[model samples]
Target: MIDKERLPQVAYQVMNEVHEEEVDLLNRLENELSDEVLDISKVDELLNTLLEHTKEHFANEERLMQEVFFPAMMMHQGEHIRVINEMKMVVNRWELTRDPELIREYFLGTLIEWLMLHINTMDTITAQFITMHKGGH
Candidate 1:
């Protein structure tokens, strides 16, 4: 099994690359938003897809931590839960208000920015724990 610490870096790498795809999706929704042309169905699909991807990524990382007996697994997972909850909150807001600009700002800017930092810092530390558990393999 891969070490937990090393796994988060790999996760981070994959995420950084995939983020552009998320951005592209967001961009596709942008015009719809700005013009008040957003199809609620489309917005729902986009958010659902993004949420799914986020869940998958977190689960994969958590599995790696579990495999290696990473001590911080629960803490790491709690963070993931927080992210999920926040996304859910955003989804609820979007559903209630149907504010395209808010969705855009949340996903494209604040959300992405938060993720970049989370992956680089907290995730890197998680990776470090994995690496150490594996004797820096």
Candidate 2:
């Protein structure tokens, strides 16, 4: 479970709300993975949901950055692309192997760590930039 209090605040309300939603999805995924029976379908569903949500979240952020003409848009967008590819790889692996332990390690370790770091760094800076430039956007 993610500690909401630990999540860093951003200058944008929408960004913060979207991040909270992401955290909620992650928490739900964690719960699903922790089940004793290991429902492959549930995990698959959650993984898909998370991927879709992430894509949408990135798209929204990218649009906002574009609106503000954010200088680091390319770099931040590159990171988004990289993460999306990584997520797709994990989902494909899950489909092929259905390995609970592997997925658990990924979500609990790599995915979570990357998300936290990205939020603290790229997202924080981007939100600040947007807030500074965005007028009614």
Candidate 3:
């Protein structure tokens, strides 16, 4: 499990809120996978929810970047797009195979790693830019 305590402090309320949501979703997925009898349907539902939330979160961040005229907006948005595309591919694989273990591996390995790196780097910079430009946290 990715320790929430290790997550970088963004100090931006909206970004932090979205980060918390992401953390909650990841933790919930991890807990669900720990069950003895894997519930494919429930895991599917959770993945869908996470995907939708991630889309919204990325959109919101992009909007904020535009509002603040953040210099790294394009690069940040590109990363968001790449992550979403990868997630879609994983979802497609899940739909075809319905393999709980595969999905769990993707979540624990690819998704979690990408998310942590993104939050710690891109998000941290974005939050700093917003707070600096917008004035006051």
Candidate 4:
């Protein structure tokens, strides 16, 4: 459960909105996983939804970075790639094992931690750079 208040805000509106969406998706997934009668299909669906959202979000950010000629584009894009790949691997594991505990621990712990740190660091820097480059838009 991500406390919205605790989330670090980025300079860009679009990025902030996407981060909110990401949090929402993860929260929903966590609720679904916490249910005792785990619906494997529902969890799978949410996971897929999150993955798709992440892809679109990252693509949008990458495009902005390119347009702005962001100096740290390579590092930021590399992080996105790494996160996406890890998500894919998790999805694959879920399909093979249907392990609720595995999903729960990963989502509630690892994923949330990673998201907070990423937003606080890489995303904050990227958004600031983009906003500054765009004359504070």
Q: Write the per-residue lDDT of candidate 3 for residues 1-137, one digit (tens) a residue.
A: 66777766785877887788888898899988989988888888899999999999999999999999999999999999988998889989999998877877888788888888888898988898898888645
TM-score of each: 0.72, 0.96, 0.93, 0.95
Q: Please list the residue runs of candidate 4 whose C-alpha ends up more than 4 Å from where it truly belongs after superposition.
A: 135-137
Ranking by lDDT: 2, 4, 3, 1
**Model 3: colliding residue pairs:** none
Residue 23's C-alpha lDDT in candidate 2? 90
Model 4 lDDT at residue 46: 94
Give all candidates' CA lDDT scores: 0.70, 0.90, 0.87, 0.89
TM-score of 1: 0.72
Clashing pairs in 4: none
lDDT per residue, candidate 1, 1-137, as tens digits?
A: 11233322433344444445545555655655656455889778878888887788788778768978887788889989998999999999999998777787887677767766777776777666666665443
Q: How close is candidate 2 to the true structure, as a TM-score?
A: 0.96
Which candidate, 2 or 4, would have the higher lDDT against the true structure? 2
Q: Where does the lowest 10-residue lDDT sum fall in candidate 4?
A: 128-137
Model 3 misses residue 72 by how many Å?
A: 1.3
lDDT of 2 by residue, 1-137 (tens): 99988888788889988999999999999999888888888898999999999999999999999998999999999999999999899889989988887877887789889999998999989988988887423
